[model samples]
Target: MAPLSKDPATLATQGKKAMDESKYDEALTLYTAAIDIRPNSPLFYLQRSICHQRLQKGQEAVDDAEIALYLAEKLGKRDLKAQAQLRRGIGYFFLHRLGDALQCLKWSKKLDEKEKSLNLWFPKVEVGLSKLEEGDERANATVPELPDVSDKIAAEKPSTPAPVSNASPAASTAVKQATGVTTPVDKIREEMIQNNTHVTWTLYVKGVPKDKASVIMEPRSFHISFPLANGSEYSIDKDPLFAEIDVDNSRSSVLSTKIELHMKKKVEGKKWLAMEAKEEDVKAEQASAPVNKPAAAPSYPTSSRTGPKNWDTIVTDVNDDEEEGDPVNSLFKTIFKNADDDTKRAMMKSYVESQGTALSTNWEEVGKKKMEVTPPEGMEAKPYEM
Candidate 1:
């Protein structure tokens, strides 16, 4: 097929059409072309930014959205300006720029009271802001006073005529001053963790006592099946593990106690997975093993409940650009990189076979149930661009 022309309006229209059809990559290319032709058009940049976001290019998306906001403001287009602000704010939220995000979102709300679209699209922004306030910085902030909804009848009560009493004017002034006073730690945290924000947790791995080491956190919990590198038949069938995390609020942050992992023993006889020997015994085995030193074993992560350090690491890990060649990624890449080796090939094999066996035995009965739930239009799976 011939390449599309780079005319601004033509590219813009094609980009919109591609976006509508969920051809996000094509839409991005078209939008970029449109911007190339008319670099000052905020609409083109903003549209391209949406595509960048869908592709999970967080930094690029934020940059494009920011440019859109600046251009929209320069153009004096209020609606477009509000949109740009909201987009940039959402991008910031994903980038963990809580303070900047809240400022932008608040301004966007002020520009347009109808925030339903923003709320729907960016529910996490609110969650993130709320969580941030709940943490160390804004934890002590006083909540805004809500009107007493207790008594409608009292509101309608007639005011009694009072005689002017010869009271000290200074005493009245003192009472008024006292009523208006703010508390020592009552200032709200400027940075907010939005309501729908995804909270990241870290699992610290360390040796017994003080010689602590590596920490890792995955989005969700799963059984760790570490395939040993050497021919050593060592295996951990079932072991208790934990993930430590920090709970943050608008004002302050606190560490959550460890999240425990309870695994059932893979072997029928053993209740707990065992090492062939105690920690001391392992030293002997290490000495006898081949002289080629195996890579250092990953230390169990510390419990985040210990302090804010875990939270800091979590934020740092998540926010750091993967392309920057961080040591943390390299460390993780080394460990469990051979998870799908021959030794662990049966990891899901038995499970699948067992399920298949049951399905085959009950196929007829299940088929009857399936007939009732079948869609009116037959379902077909197809790969589509987005």
Candidate 2:
């Protein structure tokens, strides 16, 4: 085995590279090691949460994302906080919790509307919520209840009824046609066990004649039926399997009283949560699905239309003054340069709003007009002297 690194930063760097290469399991291991070395690092938790999401571990991803969000808030890292919210929302989406998912995604959008991945996820969540609401409304519609029929039905029927047969002629005929067995079949009990390389089904059936029992297996499902001596049928209707199997390699054996079915797994080491996957869940998985490889981080616009219409021009003028080696302008430029993009945009917006006139992008003309109208409070008069 290769040596493990003691430094958390090194481990995290390696983890990111592994994720970029589509090696999610490897990335998860490396991120776990990094977390072990430095438990308080929100970035490590955030990265690991992404790995869990890709692996379809919805609960684990939600837990990790929550931790990352908490740590980011403690450290005052807004960018990381926004990303954590997005991850948490995605986890909820996978779990089919549409309301919770929508809340988180909307919060994340408020924090960073230009996030490209969020742009992709938001619409899907919206559609899911709409569908869920429609379903609820349909279910709530009232249905007419049946009228009382007990008295009329009792008066029409005879007091002494004839003995009922366990198997109706139609049922027996259908069973014979399907399984080539004349015996009556009832409900057969079954249990499924899935492992790394196979799926085994154990069926409890009593007193089935060897010649009468029939078992059929398919890639995604199985069927077994036989007649019991008690005049009842024991059989499994065509039932869906947890996952696809290799039908050619699957076979069944009759023990003294039970039937054992052995099926080779088509995909080794995959964990299945349900006996049958739901159609909606399958479609949701295909929509906004996690990729095997990490996508490049999206670039956000530094300014938006919601900010000052002339924000870009004002910033350029300030930059120009700083380049001319003016001490006051240089000091102002340094302050603005050190601030985050959101803060800078807010500042520009405030200045433009204070002007009380239509905004203009032509900074040279606007700057001259602004200087004449009234110099900004913090700016020195010398800088604006004509």
Candidate 3:
């Protein structure tokens, strides 16, 4: 496809066409471009708000809707404000904010009684509120699914070349051989590690000021950019991570010499075939993934008759006579099965890095310090000889 026209008006029109065709990602980019050029235009934000809603980005949808509402209010355009309120209410609904959603929808109705979308949203909010009152915490109505982008992904390939065939990672090293992903500059090197329950990517850079760096880790992608010593900026915005990650748990740490990103995998033990999921990969993922909408995970109820439940120990039954194929291995397996995600991560990291000389499950302590090989009292650690 040809590039979008530079004019803001043309971009907005193109965005509208794309939005109508359900090409939300394209529409979002176009609308963002238009908004950049025409900062004062409420219409652009309103259109972008719809795109965000269809993408199921509730916060972004709410933000854009508020921007449109604010601009409309200033101009006293009751009709635009009504539409904005309707979108705002839907955005709040997607965020599972029942009270806020109801208020916004009511305002939208007061502004324009004939608004068509209100008919669908009003009852959704009511149902959600009723469910909340009835002791159902996860009671929000179904929001729009994220835009299906397999076709778009297939069409737009990365500028940089990657291996046509996916390579298997080394279990011990967690990195694929001869598969280092380099950045725009030859000096920067990046590696992706598929750890036991998460993925960690490290970027080798130097002399980066803490305040000048910006790193964003999202569910499907990540973006990194920072100022270099030579007055130039280094950036790499990778879209579509090899697999989905848990955004809330995924985090980044910046050190003096390197930056590390720890991304909790959405599905445990799912190997990443590549650093980025190309066309074929996305299709396979969609095919194998669940067809139903998102469902909440079941929580273990506590017998805490008072304040918060204690995490120091959970009373779980384990049969003492259970078969032990490998006594040591069975013990580790038993401990791992009952451990949480963080504890599992800590155990893996410490055991692997310490050369099996130490094992620790305290995530807080393990995270802040580097692990070292502490051999048995009589044994000494040494480099492996070929």
Candidate 4:
């Protein structure tokens, strides 16, 4: 008789426990074990997707959430299906695919309006959409500010406006002097240097005294101004940076003829072509460079029995210039490279069983009986409050 200890449901229960304790890696391993036991279980995939998201593996989270959605649909699990959609939407949000995230969130909300998680995430999806519409540079500033709904709930008397005062002759004169003040404008030449680690911008202002110059740097913007001849001011003001920078790490230096800004990137290993990058620049780069192409296999002898005979047999030949190479090991390597850790373990288990190999003595009994388990709870998983 087959032991009930290895049931997928029981393993999933243990995975949920680990997740609650913030042991995400252990939870991932347990969930993977459950998935290996029953690949068709939507719950297992959904749990693993959450683990992937917690680990900051956006692509992996997206893949698992998609698989969970498919399985939930096949099983006619409405609640699970809605949760799967929410997971996919969250995954897309993390990937910065705002359009896709909004679409998925809309569908999820339609399917389960009362779902707490859906309600919580709906605003975030809307925020992302708003960001895309307003422009990426100003997106961070576009958070939806909810009006005071409580005031509407209660009746309140309208307040009268304050009376406007006419300016006296002396006050009018002072206002005119303030408004008529003008500063001399100077020609400021700027140069930008950018790389993976940092972005440096320098502005050269001719005929400006070093003592009169001032420079201010913020996380996302900078300002530089100097007094010119005859009390006139030459200024460069409110310029946006390429990306959000470490304000603590950034510094500005004013020399006799120039002001230099050194900005350390918030995200390391990110390449910047310009001192100020827009959403269009990032999109253009992604569109030009595709990620779906399979890596080229290393060269091998055609006659080598252990090596692949034709690479085309393993993965689609993306490079038209290269001739086909070995096929045997190429297919295995391609599949292995593309598969998740759980899928690889499942394949290994099947191979070992087929070979009549003895199971490891140290392998402990995992799943005992089917156990009902709720998804891990999060503080942010509640419905939005006005």
Model 1 over residues 1-386: C-alpha lDDT tens digits? 24866345456667777887878889988877666545556666788878877666766776777676665665566666677777776666566676666666777787776544554334344434444544544223221111132242133222223357576999866644443212121221121111222222222221111111101112111211111112111111111112112212111111121222222222223221231224444344444434332233322122123322232333244334354333323432322133323212221222122221111112223222211111111121222111
lDDT of 3 by residue, 230-346 (tens): 444455656667877897798887676688889899889778877788868766665564434223322222212233323333212222335554322554566656566666566
Question: lDDT for every model?
Answer: 0.42, 0.59, 0.64, 0.55
Candidate 2 positional error at 376, Å: 35
Model 4: residues >4 Å from true position, as ranges? 1-5, 133-386
* Model 3 stretches astray by more than 4 angstroms: 134-386
- Mark the 10 consecutive residues where model 1 has the least summed lDDT: 206-215
Per-residue lDDT of 320-349 in model 4, one digit per residue for the tens?
224343331343344444544443333333
Top lDDT prediction, candidate number: 3
> Which residue pairs clash within candidate 4?
5-367, 308-326, 308-327, 309-325, 309-326, 309-327, 310-325, 310-326, 310-327
What is the Cα-based lDDT of residue 175 in candidate 3? 38
lDDT score at residue 200, model 2, on the 0-100 scale = 77
In model 1, the runs with Cα more than 4 Å from the true position are 121-123, 132-386
Q: Cα-based RMSD of the predictions, in order?
A: 29.5, 25.7, 24.8, 24.0
Please give each candidate's TM-score.
0.35, 0.36, 0.36, 0.35
